[model samples]
Target: MPQKMVEKIEEIAEGSDDGLCDVIFHLKSQDLTLTHVVNAGGVAFRNRSLVTSATELLPPSLEVLRERQPRTIRRKTDRDAEEPSFASTIARAPISASPLEETIARNYDRLATAIASAALRPSVERVKDRTKDRFRQYRPAVLWSSESLRVALRRDDLLDLRQRTDFLASLNDVYPNQQVGVPRYFSPARSSAKVQGELSRVAWGVERVGAPAAWGAFGHRGAGVRVAVLDTGVDASHPDLKGKIKGWAEFDGSGAQLPRSRPHDTDRHGTHVCGTIAGGGHSGQFVGVAPEAEIYAGLVLNGRKGGTVAQILAGLDWAIEQRVHVINLSLGGRTLERVVRSPFHRSLFHAASIGISVVAAAGNDGSQTSGTPGNDFFALAVGAVDVKDRCAGFSGGGTHLITESEHIGPKLLPLAYSKPDLCAPGVDIRSTVPKEAWGFLSGTSMATPHVAGAVALLRSACQGFSDLPGFRQSSVIQDIILATTFDLGERGLDHRFGFGRVDALRAIDAASGWVTDTSEYRDRRNRSPVAPPSARGRLGRLPGIGPADPGA
Candidate 1:
């Protein structure tokens, strides 16, 4: 590359970092020698995955169990199981009120110094002596995968590393970590018309989507299905969430897992999202779309700064490890132009490839504003609608042009997917909040959980759907939902409303019919090739799919 071009690329990349100089490097090889060169330059690296085999090289203080663990490690049911000291230390540490960026920086500094003193020592210092000595203190934040590494490096050192032929040959790409946050928007105050009795017990959004109807007809309220809520965290003590939280963990801004994490919300956003997904109707309020579903809550965001791309990815990796059936990301972040290949996109693709239904919030910026992960082709980006089934004013919609990553996922298809796969009730949505309270929120964030919960219901109702090949399960479910939706805005798939507002009863009926018969199947990109008619249509009622409930 020309010097001017390298300078331009570096300048563009500089704007994306959170002032921590944190950048992720995807190398062509998992060889430690490539990393050793960087490490010897006084750069301390924290391994999230790659260090497993290097356990013997780790200091005695690490105390890693020598026993080889399976790649698909099951969630430890016994809380007493031994954990890494780093996790336990964090578990015992007090929650700091410091700025997230500053806190993360401090943690990295401490960790780097510790590793230098304990692990690196004389050998690393001797190697550093032979170098040009341009490098100073650098921190190891996280090792995302065997080939991907995240670290805090000085600008000059980063430039130097890029110029090295040895390093450059092994490096696939390097980019600053992006910031992520809840895609929530505030709505204007509306008239407080009080409702009493049964009508007020169940949320209007829940009823509008016909969740109760689907539950009664299919006899499945997402039973035996697992949904991962990657957000602030769920309030486990909430009445509606009792007996619903099956697993819980927290991730730092660097995407490292916090030790001994328990169920607790740093903000009400996560609690509300979780409630809408699987909260039991214990408080006489049927707030959740799938009341019987189990939750695997990962606290990826907290306080004002929210979180970073690394944190969300860590939470996502944790969710995938748990073998959850569905994932709800009620959050998003800007996709920078400088990014040639997005780690988040690849992660979503990996999740979808394994049959997990990933639902995300279409950003709240309105019009042609779409956020990443949601904008990614694999994610089922959900838009927002009001009680009257009108698209929310702040609902984001746009067409994602395939510019950088033309080939994505196992299929190697050009994933030039559009925004808002479907819409769901979001305006004035009432659900459980922290401190045992119920409140109303309006955003695409709120709508996302509705779709996620619906996916859970579909998974439970249509058992063995996982037997479908990679990505087929989620694609089929998305197809059923899109086909059964009540069309709004444009005639077919449009920006405002991708298909239309989700109709749970109709979707479940269609899924039930398809799974029972399995005679007709379609494979296409962007939209379903043909919409499956309603129960009363020409196809009539299949053996399992019955007539739509008159009460719905």
Candidate 2:
């Protein structure tokens, strides 16, 4: 811990009430159990079985939750012309044959016993291991991460723990778990206005992205692909969403998975997002991009400021169990931090490693603003555009600095990449709402599902193609979408519109005609400086992942 940071933590604690503060500890080893960590004096949060639920769902181990980290692109040096592109730098590790449900069931008893025993008084032998119980006064409720390599807990003595050198040195890193919400726009009245009557026409957004063209060409409305929406929840009974839902789950305030939870929305945000992804025809109008895709709704947010980061991770863990092809995150937090150290970022990385494409909302905060998980390298960040294909003023955009972090890397040099990987129609978009009604909403939140649904469609179109796993891979899909964009901002990749507004028709075409050689696809992408000359040009000239062009 740096001395300046220690002072800052104490300073923040000075004016705060004595409520529990959420903290995440990044462990060095995944094998350390709750009892081992607590007995080793590594956790500042004391065991409080009464405050924590015994019925908490056990998180999976790192072996199940994470695949190996994907290789990332770095700055090109004079002697590095032959260097490989980050898109296919390393081969993907095979996903476990064991389903997430089986893994969870198998580890349930081990974690239950560990948590129960850790709550008891420290044994004489265990007590002898530490000099003293410095964190004993703090009765914090702890939650084990799905990866099991990290532990998140709520403690009342945040100020006290940071000052103790012994406690701080036990973990690799620590992060504050803050509640994040859907992007907020300036004119909230218009962005969230609930229109009176349902519009019986296809949304302008669905038309603008050319989703209909893809549907016509491929004859696949994302039938075989599965997508997960982690948000407030969804309105399962909405007219357009009746048969779209396949699975549902919710995380309580304490990050525990509630058993027998039904599909319901605490707010209208989740329902609308889900509708945009796969909503079927309502009032004779088709509103969804991948109307035939299966939907998995996970309620991680409850329309309040109290929703913690742990809930999101739990939802992500559950999504993996469903073997979803795409994940729609219509919510995120705005921050200017250059490095990625958050648990959600790690989960996104793991999701990408296992061939799950994640679409996130660039914050509604305008230019120069960056949002976590969205701005994260692992995500396919999306921005909002209007009917005219103009980037929304509230859409977040900027060049994010990818610096070395304990979780991400020890890089030779920091890499800068333009954010909001692409854009989609968000202004005045109409979709489903709660109480089996329909409404209009705006913001990058509305735009994210447009892209998520596009990924589902691509996955569905490319089904049975074994060689182009790159087509299903996050980085490759990200590059392909960027390559096929309609170029909304500047000439090339820029801060506002990234590569540009997403073009689903062109993206699907590129994916369909792409060379079956996945490695060759990566090699060709590395050599091309500009996004291959649009869909009109030769299909062989596809895009690659690298630093933004210096001139652009």
Candidate 3:
């Protein structure tokens, strides 16, 4: 709805006639409370909010989230050439929301409810967590986010206080309202076949993503890169992962960092992920995507108890500080609403800004959208595909809501931005387990490591890819990966296949001085000047990798 805005003169020249001000604005559109005002008492602007209710009038929807998007026009220049014109000079309709407003609008409902509920809670600690040890289960919690916003939510109002956006300026973090969990890869446990050479020889996932072909041609297996796996700790002593664990840390159930913690794997998940990433493949066991990538394992998840959002955040912060080439988070949280922006959204954005590739799993809930973090647009979210290129039934897929802020939505199949960035093999995959053994497990979790390992390989093969300005580096690598995929389910980028099942050889070919080929991905990524001189005249040269191209 168009608001009834009352314009106020914000600034006036010294003793100007009739107190003239250039721009007029309204401090508050609702309640007309003018708590935050401009040009008041000789002050340029003053924010004095005595707001009785901080709640926005309505919840944001995908339909209205684009209100703040600026309009652009092609204007004729001196040489009759067209140049893009900004909305400000072109007299287009004004964008309704600002970045601040967008965040507030999207989160107002949930926060309001949390605040209201908190006001009624008794000031007492609970005996147990809301879901007990089942951290993967979704529940309501209240967390404060960003410094400017203050939540009146009572300490006990929300169950997960740490997950809330912190009200104190000391901690400027966005938080979830519930405990988040690493995606569960629990299927029936593997039998002795996990130990014998039966299922251990060749990782089907590595082949599914075209890793072997890349190995044969490019001869790069992620030797010069570092990868951070935030999960249950890895078994450093496992033969296949004997020397893969480089840096190690553990987080308590409360998510506190134990900087000097020892490497441990109470459960098999992280070890399996490690094995799939850089396992030595001794004893005929199939090797991981990037077998030689250094691994930094953050023991965020507990063997007996599931993981928490705070632990994940701590581990991620550590990884980003380490500046590892890629960070893989094979976990997700079931969200309450379509317009949710969990706290990790900001964290993921930070990692991206610094040029780190943070890959996460599209949840296994099989819901309409993927969970938070993975759903975040900045993270390289992955979905699960089988050897046959079929989308897994348990693999999460749905439509994601896209907003003008460019914050990514879920990786579900229904909406535009909600689909997984890409798909990878996630079923019946074999990798090293406890006791120097091998095992089979499945989930978007399994699929996520494939992409993470591939990133290590890509970063090693193409130094130029990571050397770009931090923000552009990940995009270029993503473009390369997306550019040379084997489209499945749908022809182009879709909810199921994402960019498509990742093709390692094609990605290697593109990164290994082969981008000059005439493929869609290469053509799109081949920009001059923006790219280094070494990249000039190198794109769109080779024949495109088509559906039936040899070795495709």
> TM-score: which candidate is best?
2
After superposing candidate 1, which stretches have Cα over 4 Å from the reference?
Answer: 1-9, 12-20, 27-147, 169-172, 187-198, 335-341, 406-416, 519-552
TM-score of each: 0.71, 0.73, 0.64
Q: Which residue pairs of candidate 1 clash?
A: 87-259
Question: Residue 43 in model 3: shift from native, Å?
Answer: 37
Tens digits of per-residue lDDT for model 1, 1-552: 335335543763566443335666544432232222212111111221121221111111111111222121123442212222122212222212233244335434543553354222443344345333532323344433223455554444555544545444444555566567655556336513532223476677777677776676666788899999999898999999989999999988766787987889988899999999987478777789999999999998884678877788778777876878899999887543322245565456456545688899987888787777787645788999876678888888776554332122222222234568689988888889999898888999999999999888878887756555433455456556666677778765677777677777767665554555433321121233222333224212423324343433
RMSD of 2: 12.2
Q: Each candidate: what lDDT? A: 0.62, 0.61, 0.55
**For model 2, what is the error of residue 477's alpha carbon versus the real structure, in angstroms, after optimal superposition?**
2.2
lDDT value, candidate 2, whole model: 0.61
* Ranking 2 against 3 by TM-score, winner: 2
The candidate that achieves the highest lDDT relative to the unseen native structure:
1
lDDT of 3 by residue, 449-537 (tens): 99988888877776655434444455456555655566677555566766577766666655554332334333333331022232212
Ranking by TM-score: 2, 1, 3
Better of 1 and 3 by lDDT: 1
Model 3's alpha-carbon lDDT is 0.55
